[model samples]
Target chain A: MLWAYLHCYQLTLDTYTPLQQGGSADEPTVVYHENSNSVVQMNAAAKQHGIELGFGLAQTAALCPQAHIIKYDKDVEKQALLSLAHQLYPLASDIVINTEHSLAIRLDNLLQYYGGYDVLWNTLTHEINQQGIHYHYATAWGIEAARVLAKSQINQMLRERTAITKCLAHCKLSYTDLDSKALNALEKVGITSIGQLLTMPVHELGRRFTNDTIRYLTALRGETFPTRTLFRPSSTFKQHTVLPFEVENSQHLLPYMGKLLDTLSHYLRARNLTTSSLCFEIQLREAEQQVMPVSAATPFTCATAWLDLVSLKVERLVLQQPAIALTLLCEDFEPIEKDTNDLFSDRFTHLAQKQLIGRLKAKLGEQSTQLPALGNSHIFEKMTVYQAQGNGQSYGFDAAPTFLLDHPKPLSVASRVCFGPLRLQTGWWEENTQKQDYFIAQTPQGVRLLVFKDTESKWWVQGVYS
Target chain B: MKDSLSLFNNHPNIWRAREQPANTSRFALGIHTLDEALHGGIPSAGVVSIACTTGIGEVSLFQQVISQQRKHKLRVFINPPAHVCAPWLTTQGIDISQVLIITPDNDADALWAAEQCLKSAACHCVLLWSKTMAAKTARRLQVAATHNDALCLLFSLASKKPSSLPVSLELSLKAHEANLTVDILKQRQGWPVHNLSVPFSWTPDNHAIQWAIKNNKRKVHSLHSVS
Candidate 1:
């Protein structure tokens, strides 16, 4: 089996001080944890200025006064790693992220599909570069050996155990999974590299070092398999982002909500899915949460379409309190089918129709728009039922008014029936049976109406044909 | 960017004028006289206001437009005066599913619903009923309809309103002697035409005709129908 390890060596610094536009890459940066009272990470420029990781914050400043210090955000780092895993998931057979800074992917199955290792390596590198992340990769016969090679920044693909062992001879002992005390003890005993450590007999090393060290060394050489949990995409999407400030009005909350939607779009795209509805919740200060649902008539994946609908919802919203946080949850997702448009079909028209329905549903309400389906029923009202609009086919049946009255209204005696005896009667099985003769009539004034006479001989005006 | 900006700036007429007068774009008001008077047809976009007396066939006009336009897109009725007869609409070959009826509580809700439907581009036409409207709301509705290239027609019951209302076409409709009289009070880029008679096909029942004639003759007396 062939495995490739993507080692994100800069994860700590990247998480702490995200490279912003126009920020100098050569600037000295350090990540200082105040609770631990030490510098956890520093860039190469900071190292050049005599500032090393694990230095106290005071010592860091003393060593390099111009170094920029930032606190590491673990949540952001975990999210970044997970997002990377999702992007790589579709390209690999199986992926296991064993540590915060690296992921191991099974690549033997993909070699044939990707036209061998070189093409896959180029594609992977291009994608990583496009996303503006720095990574080093190594491929070996086993997962642990590949991970060790990747930690040493060896960007080589080794298929044989002999070649992998030769490469491991140069890898530093500090890069392995051994404890600092054990490593330091070994260093004092003239063992500074993995090569020297492996030279010692297995039984001798097991007696001298802890059991974990022996096992780690065994795993490092691809001698024993290491345990790793396979990464899987979550079934439902729930992303929350704290607003920068307390937003008193819905309009002010749009920018924050927009950011959350962008993240949700990224999540959906990675999974190749689309959602018809999403629940948007706003957590307010000392007030009940405002949960608004934004839905489309059709399942949609476009970020802008969802953003537009949610923006309309926000516009019509009356915020009861100042919102301090926002959460977007979309639990239901359907596999998205990419439509291949025909040359004859007008693409804009179809998109425009969907946009229109989405806008109408957002502004007017979900019940505002519907599609008509012809049912097999004798009663006129029962013959046509308005179903909620989606991808359902619209049935074009016999001539009928586009409008239907909710209830029949009694007509005045002065109202005149112009056309009559379009008989319609049904509901025999049910208690509310109807025996009626319907008419397309005009009132004495001029207004055309649809009137009907029930079996009891009472006349009612069903609707004005407006 | 400079070339694109200047290209549009140099040819303002490209954005201002109607792109085409094809059947796909323009709505046939279903009356030949009205269509001719509209110079091709009711524009696919922009608001057309109908100032009417009671029973003047404004509902019939909207119904005709709805029936015709349903083939292309949905039709929206905002604040319809009465319930629409679904079965009747069905018999007219109008897709009942393509029709949306909205009953708004007040003028603001009605105006908002109208603007939304117009801007949605989901509906080929939006028919709105309003007794009165502030000029600003009418302007907003006009802009929305134009932006989405959808038709918006407002049926106003009060006929004696201002002549300078924001609308593409303003016509006063009056039903007289079994014929609908359409008076073009205002129209864009055309002279105001008055008292053009459009023939109405449906005739009232004989008994109702007798009742109406008697009521007219009495003038001060109420006439009840013989049931």
Candidate 2:
């Protein structure tokens, strides 16, 4: 149809401000039913006066005053909207966002589940209004016609399937079937409404209109609606949110992120899943969004695990402004595998050991803990050493004297016995100044070890029998 | 020096639990004797501290532990300073294929890696070449060893002995002939520690040095001392 029905609202008055005063965020107040980038939605008094949606600021304040105007934040709005989409994903086959405040969804499949069209509409409207939003809806065969009707009509009927096609056929099908350029001549002929435009011949419409217009007209008549295959879900986890308006502060997104975390954690736990890797994406107003990724060495889950891994990656953010939208996604994850360990068996001891080791490592640090090994050397001065990895050896046993003289019991011998059993002298040049007389003895207990007399003539045992 | 390394080195040797004369899996170091008398043997995991002021037979003792564990198929990871003569441990019955040497430039790294291995519960035993360690870390290792059922040993230069230790055996050192005089100072499992000592020494066969033959198998000789 050649009808040019404009949504008559003083949206600009309440939407924007002097470009100098506000810059990119500055705009007029009258909040359109949808964020009409064509008009501002941030004018001060107009917004306060309940003059929001589809108006100019200059015109808004004149009609109504005392409005709390807001600046345009497309990024935030897109994010908030996308998040809403994820939540409602189970309801519809195709949900297309028209603008920040508007959505185009096919309700045929979900109609029965929702108890019919009116019930669904009422529920959706209630949900939207609960978010402090004043909303409106429009339906037409063509996407552009739907947008225009939604703007022009303050309150539109919700149509279902074939009925939707019938209701939208007039305005949508006419322009779609004959195209406007073909109707430009009709325009000169004083033809406008679809009723009037239909009188024109089809060949005339095709001859004058573009192919797109003709195709859309057929589409509106239930011949086609761009049938897309049932969406095949991919193996990924994603979360997002939509905003009533745009926002730029990063902190402002925390509450939204909290909601995402709740949803994500529930999803994972339901499937007994754990993820050690995740990705984050933030959408901007007009520029490309940013993507950040996080990884852990092992599978992790719930709030604590995810938070720990994320904290490391988020420490490097350098944003000068706030993010408008956010998305949390987990592309890969592992299933939570089960393990069996007896409650009181030694197998559980490893966990205990882990606890002890962790506590010590935390307190004393890693450097302080070590395992002793044997020093590989011959000279007494060179040999008496322990390495951390002593090669799984027991001490003094391998080198114990095979001859068991006796067990541990004091030898009441002369304190300074000049027993020339064996004068062992070595390491003189290597600073090992030693002059010792050694002996192998058997105590009353049948213990055998190497004993020696120092230069001072005092006797003592050095090592024990295995 | 890169000599200090754990079993993690992609060498042919690998991590295996102790399995042998099953009873020997538990080494009952005369707690009454060695525990109070000296630093404990190598830790099942974590750092084990030991030192010799005089003829302590440090290498000989390390060899015994290594040989025993090796007999049960446990691998020995060695990290020694540049001064350690590798042949000494071999001479004490430690299997050549079982011994993995990690020469280390930083003594601290060697110590840390050794503890980590023990902490992992992957290796039968771990050893660090060190002269000293913090008391807290030593105790933690004792607890870990008990939990994981593995042993850890640390070698340290003898200074002042630790006041309270978790060691099962403590020995006072003296040398006579080719034996190490082990004076029993403390025992954990009721090992008697009086003025008496265990006669132990290492002897070489081919390139392997081992703890002397069974004390009972040796010649029946006794030292009658003055009253």
Highest lDDT among the candidates is held by which one?
1
The true-versus-predicted C-alpha distance at residue A51 of model 2, in Å, is 5.8
The digit string of per-residue lDDT tens for model 2 on B14-127 reads: 323332211212443433344334334323333344444422355455555557652433343435432233334444555533343444446565555555555555445655
DockQ of each: 0.22, 0.03
TM-score of each: 0.69, 0.39
Find the candidate with the highest TM-score and give its number: 1
Instruction: Give the TM-score of candidate 1 (chain A).
Output: 0.66
Q: Whole-model lDDT, candidate 1?
A: 0.72
Tens digits of per-residue lDDT, candidate 2, A313-392, equal 45445444456667889878788867423574334444433333333332233334222344444334334243444464
Per-residue lDDT tens digits for candidate 1, residues B153-177, read 8888854546677777787887765
User: Which tens-of-lDDT digit does each residue in A64-120 have in candidate 1?
Assistant: 888877666566456667766766766764889777767888877888898877788
